[model samples]
Target: MLDANLKKQLDTYLQNIVSPIELSVSGDNSPKSKELLELATEISGLSGNISLREAAAGRTPSMSVAPAGQAPRVSFAGIPMGHEFTSLVLALLQAGGHPSKASPELQEQIRNLEGQFHFETYISLSCQNCPDVVQALNLMATLNPNISHVMIDGALFQEEVNQRQVMAVPAVYLNGEHFGQGRMSLEEIVGKLDTGAAARKAAALDDKAPYDVLIVGGGPAGAAAAIYAARKGIRTGLVAERFGGQVMDTVGIENFISVPYTEGPKLAASLEQHVKEYGVDIITDQRAAGIRRGELIEVPLASGAALKSKAVILATGARWRELKVPGEAEYRTKGVAYCPHCDGPFFKGKRVAVVGGGNSGIEAAIDLAGIVEHVTVLEFADSLRADEVLQRKANSMGNIDIIMSAQTTEVLGDGSKVVGMQYTDRVSGESKRLEVAGIFVQIGLVPNTEFLQGSEVELTRFGEVVIDNRGATSMAGVFAAGDATTVPYKQIIISMGAGATAALGAFDHLIRAGS
Candidate 1:
């Protein structure tokens, strides 16, 4: 049932619809289906222009919204609950002749696009990042008949999800081929589509003449390195599966030195822009599979292409460590989540739990407490590991509850979504169950250095690349930085400084070799 306050807000948003929209719901008469239907009916009742109807049996719960005369080109298959609720609302507004949120340049590109293109975006209902991508694709579909898009609920279609090997939400497939994953900007989406439509593949680089510097990864560290190397008038090349790395998944970042406050995507965009200002060859959508050291270092790509470089800088960042408990994997997008910033909105007005009592966990709890009904933080340690200031702030929040010595045993779900979780008290040896709509895991991070296996790169036991003060690795002409390295701190400012140091070290190596 919709809360009165939420219903009122939805009513206000719907009242401004300038055109009529049709919402078609479909599914068996199961409890989930009925719940979705009831919500749809209530939404439809709020506005006179909006109407609802049931689709044929076996079809998933989908909404096909279109203006009075136009046929629906955008369809969403899922309950559109959680953070996805905003996606539904935006879709309806677009169908009702509202202006698109995409940039004018993007809209022009979409209109100019030719040939048939099908975009299938897999999303978890709770993922906040998924909506922007889905909405952008949907807007493209609405603008051009040749382009079409559909949103697939990863949790509802387990078989399809497994077939695609979807590891995370916001996984976009272009023309049945996996395009990319995570929070992608409109430019990235359009660029991928352009490449996919042309059937372009990575080409092997000529070993005879290698780049002056080749950077692995495309986070703040790699981007900074590229810019610095390019400033030295060298042939700089950067290879990355995605430009922003883990920063794209992050939200508010206040401690970035000069920048008093900024969001992750905003900072990432600035980094990419700064790198582009130089002569760095930014190669996106490519993963470094392995490295071979010789006179010229060779980095092999997962796409079967190899790039050779005189010097290499490894800045492959880290990913959030997962809790390997039961139901954690099965209900990853359903209820269990890693990024509170990305999925917190979906749990609005609902009780949620956060596993961990570190600074990140406490920050997540405080951030979620503003939107969610209540936030319960469970920590395995005897006391909170967060800073005293952060702990005090979290404690002051009435909606936030901190539980110490609580070890998460399992995530409990109803085969569709997360319903609650079980934990054991470390001190008391007592088991307890907490009914929660979602669980945000804020464990530490694991470095992404598996590609360095069998390579000459030195690494710590935790898999982080070993580096010196100058960011120089054990191997000559090779460097490492960012969270993947043995840096004392894993902050953005520190990574950028490390990257600059590595670039300077590489430049010095090149100068000495030339001398």
Candidate 2:
């Protein structure tokens, strides 16, 4: 099933395998089964250490990758192609005893887990966030014999998805119970499974010495600031709940300078790698709760640990703006999704509504028109705010309908999932209802400045941190940048520049303070 170029690449990757492994597949005479067998056969043909065998599993058309003649730990219930293809390669390498790049501490944590964990993840091939969760669980399975995992393609196994009422991609189940949905990092997963891990980590963090510059986010802004600060030859540290922030949820990134094209997760990985090269102390899976100003600026984490720094750069970034209407929160992931790129596949052949008229909203409508049966766009303004080209493209699509002066009132659901949406017509003063299985919200973003509400830092009415040209906030010694600040434009390149400015501003403050 793999092309010649793919076979060459696969062969090169398989050379890293140090031990024997088996691809035991369970399939029947069906076309999908044949496809699975063909894929396994092609993979086995590349390396002498790899072998193939026919086996029985609860789910047909499944393939298990494991050590030779041993119980399988990592399995796939459907073809692991598209975004998950990398996951399959990693599974093969890890199963064959190739060393994993996970930190030594994290590997040890996985090996020490006491209880059995059978994880089943349902995902769509088009989802940009599914690979992270799949690879994370697969890593756990490969590390601990007590843990096992299976990645199931939601589109290929519609019956199972319906039975579980899984309306979102990357839905994970632990021991047959709903564990989580959406993008999850390996560290987050381990933290959830190991209850005492957080407290121990917090205690360790509390003992660390003060930093010259501390960055409180891990997006492009935080990464750039960390690199700039570390290069100044002073102590630098960065804390992030997740390294990528909103960028991780982004899809195509064609506008980033120097690089013509890239994806969100790929760019995020590169950013992390670049930051690592600078020897900055990086902390993940920790959310900043609040900041306290003293002789040294202190940032408190939700884990009860406080980090002190001579200068603090706030680049906490932004998140998707919610509808906040009744039933919207309850029906989230039950048919109300924020990311059209990730959740659009699940709404194939169904009607859906896009709740905005800007670039993001119209773009979502255009993208959904290809897969969904019909797309209804509800714009609160009298006219569309999207670019003329986008408006023209959306208008050209036959399956798309645009409504003007629409004010979304409430999301209507059948107590289980979304069945429709209610909106008010500002022009006619009429209430209208549209039957849609899914509601994709693409309104805008809300700055991640809620934690600074009670603090002395000045904020705009919209909660954005007020900053000067040097990226210094209202409070002395505390700088702000990126989407969380009062930057005029919220773009990746702009954030990077803002980050550098903030780092320089912090350095100047430190020099003056020490003098």
Clashes of each: 2, 0
Look at candidate 2 and give me any clashing residue pairs: none
- After best superposition, candidate 1 residue 37: deviation in angstroms? 25
Top-lDDT candidate index:
2
Which residue runs does candidate 1 get wrong by more than 4 Å? 1-128, 135-144, 149-181, 184-199, 204-209
Task: lDDT for model 2, please.
Answer: 0.94
Runs of candidate 2 exceeding 4 Å displacement? none
RMSD of 1: 8.4
- What C-alpha lDDT values do all the predictions have? 0.83, 0.94
Question: Which lDDT tens digits does candidate 2 get at residues 1-515?
Answer: 99999999999999999999999999999999999999999999999999999999999889999989789999999999988999999999999999999999999999999999999999988788999999999999999999999999888888998899899988999999999999999999999999999999999999999999999999999999999999999999999999988889888888898899999899999999999999999999999999998778899999999999999999999999999999999999999999888889889999999999999999999999999999999999999999999999999999999999999999999988999999999999999999999999999999998889899889999999999999999899999899998898989989999999999999999999882
